[model samples]
Target: MSDKVVKRPFVNNNCIGCGACIQVAPNYFDYNKEYLSEAKKCETYNEQDVNNAISVCPVDAISWI
Candidate 1:
């Protein structure tokens, strides 16, 4: 198997204040003053959890870089 690395999660401009990411991975995401979901200050290197959060985003605003 090739060793691939999952990048950290990031919120994009498409965010619609949905809480799906937060619900799926609270440790990696939080809401900002604009009610938009954003990545938490601490890096959540857990690829699975981050991917789960990305998958649940209704707006598909979450991505990795």
Candidate 2:
């Protein structure tokens, strides 16, 4: 077997769509017309993307766990 790791994230109710996370990391974070933050699926990004989200989350809603 392999030891590959995968991560998936999504926008929760707390998402205010401030676009801060997207500005820090565009490869993963994005905003809708309403300006809400969105995270890619678990297998869509690496650790870097997740960290960016966590760091940019003003509400502390983004977490690895």
Judged by lDDT, which candidate is best? 1
lDDT (C-alpha, whole model) for all candidates: 0.84, 0.70
Model 2 shows how many backbone clashes?
5
**Leading candidate by TM-score:** 1
Any runs in candidate 2 off by more than 4 Å, and if so which? 1-4, 41-43
lDDT of 2 by residue, 1-65 (tens): 25445546666768877777888777777776677877654444677767877887898766654
User: TM-score of every model?
Assistant: 0.83, 0.69
lDDT, candidate 2, equals 0.70
Q: What value of lDDT does candidate 1 attain over all alpha carbons?
A: 0.84
lDDT of 2 at 58: 95
